[model samples]
Target: MTTATRTLQLKAAPLIVEAEKEKKPVKVRITAYTGGIMTVPGWGPVIIDLQGLDLPQRVTLLLDHEGRTEATIGWGIPKTDGKTLVIDGTVTEATDAGKLVIALLKDDVPLQASVGVETNQYRPLKPGDTITVNGQTITVESDTFLIEGGILREVSVVPLGADKQTMVTLAAGVRNMTHQPAPPENSSPGETIEAKYILDLLSVCGDDMSTFRQAIENRLPLETAKALAETRRRPVIPPVLNAEVKDTPASILAAAALKLLGKESLAEKELGAETLSAAASYKPRTALDLCGMACQMSLGYAPRGTNEIIRAAFSTTDLPVALGVAANKIALDAYQQAPATWKSFARIVSAKDFKEHTGIRLTGDFKLEELAAHGEIRHANVGEETITYKVTTYAKMLMLDRQHIINDDIAILDQIPTIFGRAAARKVADLVYTVLLSNPGGFFSAAHSNLITGAESGLSVASLAEAIAALRKQTDADGLPLDLVPRVLLVPPELEATARQVLNSVELYRSGGDQLPAGNPFAGLNIALEVEPRLSNTYFPGNSTAAWYLLCGPADGSFLVAFLNGQQGPTIEPVDPGADKLGTGWRCYIDIGAAAADWRCAVKASGA
Candidate 1:
């Protein structure tokens, strides 16, 4: 409010006076401001003392607030009528911008007025404070500064104004409005919009000076100029491309490896049909050829020698990642092909991190209690038992030397990574079987009534029935029968045929001197047979070919194989090869753990 000067723009409707149709100069009357309390943006509430308002005999009327010579519409004599400041003016200019005001007046359209003032003397007032100005009692509802003394510099005709109650009037039928020369034929109605108005609009839309100059030169309408400015203001967006350009170099290399292995069909299936078609182009390349491509793509030059190519490729980021991804794909394929007997009898779960994962078993109170009539059922606190385990990182490194690349052996890439994958799978299987064979916490014991040993406890129809019955008769933490069923028959590789025969045969028979056939009760039971070679391997501390187990489905929470973050297979990572090293190296690793979860769901036979 204390700024050097401030302009308060107010809207006014032109009042049509008595007709002067033959007059050469059209005259009009306007109430610039119905002086009272007005809210000015930034300045807040402002009260103008009408008596202190200074007026000139011939105040220039400018278009908007440009103040240029061409913007002068005409001059007007301003006077006060106790409360409102009125202006009597004439339409005396012929400029295109001024003509818009003349046209509005000639057609009896309303006009707006804005008065610029210089604040010379003022008094600030607090809320609810009363002050006397020009014999009128004014009580401010908010903090405001009263303009006790000010000079009315000039007035302007704007398309829109801040205040909406003032009025402007044109004499009726004063048809010959323009008193000056006509505009050129090239001029347009868009010219009526002031350049400053257009500039302000462009500035709001974040347009440069070039765009503003274009709008002025072309004399574009307000809406059209706004649209152009908006279009240029938007952020630029990039276009989308197909897989050949979109896919990473690593993924492309993996697809190419599949192509080299003469398994192009699998490559399409492994990576969607559209995935490898563009990158591999149905062609295969050796390890050496791949290194050369990587060098050319990354270093922008063809490889010189096999040794340099291998060194340079290993040095670059994309080449190592590409090689790692290719190796991982091959390793994963082999890992899947390798047998994992644990999957059939144990549940597979994921660990989030190295932190120990607690498996909570809810029991006892889970059974619903009876409810009384018109009474709510009470909540029960179920019994909980937890087992904790954490995943461990297992890894090994493989080095691919210059000679290996020089020989251009694709088989090395295929066989080495495959071995790593199988090894990783074997590691997981070993962990799971170790926990089972260790019989941690007596998982299979006489106290639990799940372990059986006798002459008839060997692999036979009667032994399977007894094991299944024992598993089904097992109790919960509260001594309630779990009602479990045998879903899998686990045995050593040596007993695979016998175990299968026990479940698949239509009739069972004695293996001793007696060959008489007995009834096969397990023939119709859909029990899966899983044979693990490690169960009988001497590498383990307790290896037994004659020992076998009957287990419940994985959902019964008998045992679980947990992989970190659900990454079931191993991952291959490239190692940085420094100056001393002559070859590239990759470390393949897996995060995994295993443990026996519950004892009630499994029954073991000694087969003595």
Candidate 2:
């Protein structure tokens, strides 16, 4: 649980699936904290993503020693030994499930008189072995007897060539393991035992930073605890997988950062992730902050926090005396033993407690008081204060050996703006699509939001008013899409009159006087806003609106979200960063009612 005051090196490094063949720490890759520290087994060829390093390059770290081995672990992928479980007599009639039915005459296991026969992964049946079920140990009876959910289902076996590592998925969901009065005399310790991937590493690391440190720092291969100096480490458990990552835009990422650091005021006092997201779609950094505040949010759903901000105040220092549950791997990335949830793991990290649990010890010069306080510049404590964070993240397209670094394509980014709203979406859409419309290389979210940027000359904040005034000239243009396009960016509620002028239009005889073709199904429609605070690219928790099929085609104009305070509250408000909130934000998503219905007239005439 405790980190080292000296060097925070890789501990009990687990060999990435194919790590053995590759030599040296140079091959080590940095995957993100799957909620906790990981074992760096040794060396291999790999891609490394470090702090400030978006594109992965080659980097290496020399491992002190591999982990010490424990007792003969269980589930050591055992094989059939070229033998099979045999039923001598004859096959009986097939059961409804198509299983062969057999009547037991003489049984190998004296405990039970009969046995069931079925075709499993490999061999048919074996002999001379005891088949146990729910504490009932029995040998193979003459041939086979009908049985279901018995030994085959209860006991896990290895295939002919498997090396005894338990399947991560199978190990994650197991509980109250099928026990016997006495386990088979021949089964290996780990074979009958459930493999707790994430926790298993923690258990080996234990609660003490020094001991855990030595265990990992030593880089001892999977040896016994007796061989190496103890690294007492209490594990900071990983979070359980409960949320899924869906489509989010890149603007959402940028916008969140702006809102959080800007510290915008809002109506709600609670100020959680949901409300913040709905209130300001343009600010994403704030949403990322919200995600870390709640234990429930996870990378599978929104993988934007930690990397986006500095989180020194929240690191764990406490120790854990006992484990509540085992760790499971839900993500396909990283090792197969990641935990589904590690909130409990974090709560215990504030104090020095790992020594008693894990055999590792916390060596070096640091103390608890010094580590928990603010950042400092003391030469003596520098080594202890620094953290060696290891991450192993994977993305579809990685840029390497290129003229310049990869750029974020704003278009693809829009699809994943986990914390954006209608206005932000429109802006991002325009930016992304516009870039696509202009660039020959095409559009990508990474290139747009992070990569592509406008020069300072593009437009200054002071000149924004002039731009709005100039835009007004086109508000009532003869053949433009709108007499005046909505000038939502940088314009606040104080500019409502200006907004109204643009939306309603300065002129009446405009070419296009409709929302979008007639009967747009969603015409006159309204929507409900799901607000969040501090979480990035996250949706409102379980508050999804009912799904309704749209009647209008692709060109149909539709309304997504319209802000409202409440039943008796105002829908829109002027920007007032000085106040906690100007008014409550609400929404109404609608479809174009009539193609020829003057949109400006309808909006201007409405009470809103």
Candidate 3:
């Protein structure tokens, strides 16, 4: 018996099963153990000796290394075949788990095979050592080892296997049936093929277990499953047709945009090519043009001029939603395109509500301890701290009146929102920088052990070294070294050239007394330099172009910018302008808040 476990990858052939036969147990043959260099968790890399391979006559097959009886779905007989170990097994279709395995196999779902072996004879090999085994030369890189013998204790079917080369080959399903049934009809061939395709897609995107199970139970349509899978892969807020837009007018506008963007294929597929073709006939030029189109669709007649179109659009119930959709698209594009440097180094989270949210900062997990024979196991304590912040709304309104529509001043709808969108992005940047520049209660001072000042602290190789050292010296709540690495260098526009020189230059020479050339330590460090003009803007308090910061990546949890409901960007919605106001007004706002979460992940160099 062996104590050490090694995972090996092996190649497998596709599962082949006939549809005409009665359902029975699935026969499987797999290359259990492929002799080669494998990296074992906790033990590093090791090579199992095939000639010294030890195993029982049969071993139970489990699921993902679970030791319970319910996990044991089958058993296999193992035998040595050259450098590999092969296993022939039958997975019974009696149990639910067993039935699932068979069904997945029949649907062409790929399941990897892993074996849990215990190594009894093994020894660590020295670095740079070379040995010949299984007709291949192996070199020791780190903590490499050689296992002389091991027992193939158990086999398991897993979602992901350490070995990529090994695979479970399912045998052609032919059962010893007692009786034969009448042949099935082929009347529903189309539906059968569609169902099969959908099932295959479901298996491929089976990572979302709940969605996968739901799709399987309901036997969802191919398009619906595809949409769900695609949405699961990468979630994005579309420019239109999102949750906010539900009315017919908004849908029409969304469809029109989709048609204009040449993404008509999906729309055409879902809503006939004829419908899209008709929409293509009427191309809306301006806000007034869209209003006129909406009026015609809802009122059965197009308004005469821009004023009438705007009035008609404003009068309709769902017409504003359509106008809002177009405005939102413009604003969203601009907001995304605008620069927001804080995103580079600050963690952004979604706040569930406006109430004060408590964020738990777990310094680190408890270390694993050894247990003595019959000794009581003690629980280790974890280090944690709480930080609280709440999201608040910030907004302003832009009016789309009759004047702009009559004059056809497109900037009122286009460039105005574009400017506001960029401003919304800038607003977030301002809030994040304010936390540092304000330096409330000396947050970045010597007391915090993060601030470096004086003329010598200016942006340079030497100064950056000091800042990097400060950040790396940060410790967790447990008083252990965090070993935080600085990933971004934040500077004002005035120090952009200096920051680039320190980061990009291959070598440097010290000024004054020492003129000796030295290799730039910051070069090739992959530290990004982000220059924010607002940091030195006179409009802000404590404005200093000389101030620069070295910050860890966002994952380090140094600083945080939270959004209400995880909406990172601004939200634009249509607002009633009242009687005095002629046209529709749009309110652009963002629900967000920023605060210092962890002081250890950033070091400020006051370049005064």
Candidate 4:
């Protein structure tokens, strides 16, 4: 602890503090405690015992712990002149020299800890290497890791730059990546709904400077950021309910419902099938246009007429995310959030719970029956050894399905023929149930997200990881993920030799002048990552499967909701009670994908 000092050139009250290390960093004020002395014993390496020291010859005051001259004031002032003057000082410098070490403080009881250096001293000789450590926690990016005596868990590593690495991991409640989930035997998907309410007005919520100030601060709540907004008539803009001009997820989802009813498409075509920037959530396509394709390819379920389910699109909100009308108007355009462009569309089907939408939603821990569902782990190495499947890495795996949709009928799926059979289906369902419900070793809970498991369709850890890595950044390293944003991140598999160039060079953010300037309004580009692991559960780090999204729009921009799917990976089994098969496949693409959407998009194309 260090304090600034002022050259006492006043001829009034005497300022004194007891000579002690604890009484450091004092403020020189001639207030009520003018003649009072503050004493502190010692701090860090320094100890003070104010014994004999020079003092002013006039009626000066004294302050010392051990009577040694810790500091002096009023050296040559006239005797007792009751005058008041304010003295301040210049700022101080920063250095590691005065820094205090931090640690995981234990609440139960304090432990006997010495310098950690001596404990790890017995390691293979190396200089500057972390020789020894105990009870240590480190955060790199969006992941948190703990080390005890030198072991890592909950945190993994991946290469980023040639010389550096990106500390990435999945968030909670996401059984697999691609942000999809399945429904179970009884329940069904909610009806294709419309935004019964629209957020079109703006009003002042309140004027609490503290709360308002907190909101306007960087990366805080947009509605209440008082300082961030113009301090004119009102500092705060109410949400859709009040003056909230931004679009709400609920409202957008509702708009998609209307599209199913034979109205004009929510997403109007700028050119054609390309998802338009003016679309809701910044997606290029509508849910209805894509859900049918997803059902046909992934679950083998054809929509009777129009499948009614909650349509969703996932993307990132870069600054000025074409709030169509707002972007049209240069002034408001600045407020539009430009979401990353990898928007995937899908519909959550509630009616097809038992048939096309079939998945096991494991509500509890892994039980014996769950294991039996898998039959034998390869050579029946179950309890004896760890029969680890893709346990959730979010590691990008190359996609065999070309058009950005999961397909079970891919040629690569046929190779692992074992992974596409009946027992495997049960295992897959159980895994989906577990993936939907379990965390492997994370804080996500499937129940919190209301996941629906099903038969006709499912997600492969490989695909999910690839998509996740491509879209998000592990910004927060805290265990609870407070600062975590539902951005995207992805990686390609080692085998994607053909597509590696495009996946790496174009999809990734590079310095081709596409590099975003520091503090760009929109979140930087995050999409179509390099594929790596081939399964969803096995690839995402910490087996994290949870994500989040915040949908925003300009005052004038509006959107229609639609459904789409990015996965239809090969089938492992079918357990559809509604269908004649033992288990149905996942349909509706990923109506129930990750707990959080993690992306945004403007509605792209729409049709009646």
Which candidate leads in TM-score?
1
Summarize candidate 1's per-residue lDDT along 480-547 as a digit string, tens digits.
77888889999988888888888988866567787665767786787988888888899987789899
How many steric overlaps are in each model, in order? 4, 161, 9, 146
- Candidate 3 lDDT over 1-608, as tens digits, reads 62333333324333333332364677887666566666433233557777765565467787655444556678777777557767787787666667777788777787767666544345567777777665455666665657665555577676555434433211001111111111123322133435666568666667655445545544555456666666544332333324431223345654454454444664454344654565566686655676666555543344465555676555543355544555566676779899989988999888987789888887664555789688988675676777778888888778877887777664555566678789888888889888768876677889789999888998878799999899888887666788788999999999999888889888787678886757887767879999999889998898897989999999986789999888877776665465556677667778889888888888898885
CA lDDT of each prediction against the hidden true structure: 0.67, 0.20, 0.65, 0.21
Give TM per candidate: 0.57, 0.18, 0.55, 0.14
Candidate achieving the largest lDDT: 1
Assess candidate 4 and give its lDDT.
0.21
Model 2, poorest ten-residue lDDT window?
317-326
Local accuracy of candidate 2 as per-residue lDDT tens digits, 538-572: 23221211111101111221111111111111111
Query: Between the candidate structures 3 and 4, which one is better when assessed by TM-score?
Result: 3
Prediction 2 global C-alpha lDDT: 0.20
Q: Cα lDDT of model 1 overall?
A: 0.67
Query: For candidate 4, lDDT tens digit of each residue in 474-493?
Result: 22112122222222222223
Which residue segments of model 4 deviate by more than 4 Å?
A: 1-493, 498-593, 596-608
Q: Which stretches of candidate 3 lie over 4 Å from their true place?
A: 1-241, 244-247, 254-278, 285-288, 303-309, 375-377, 510-517
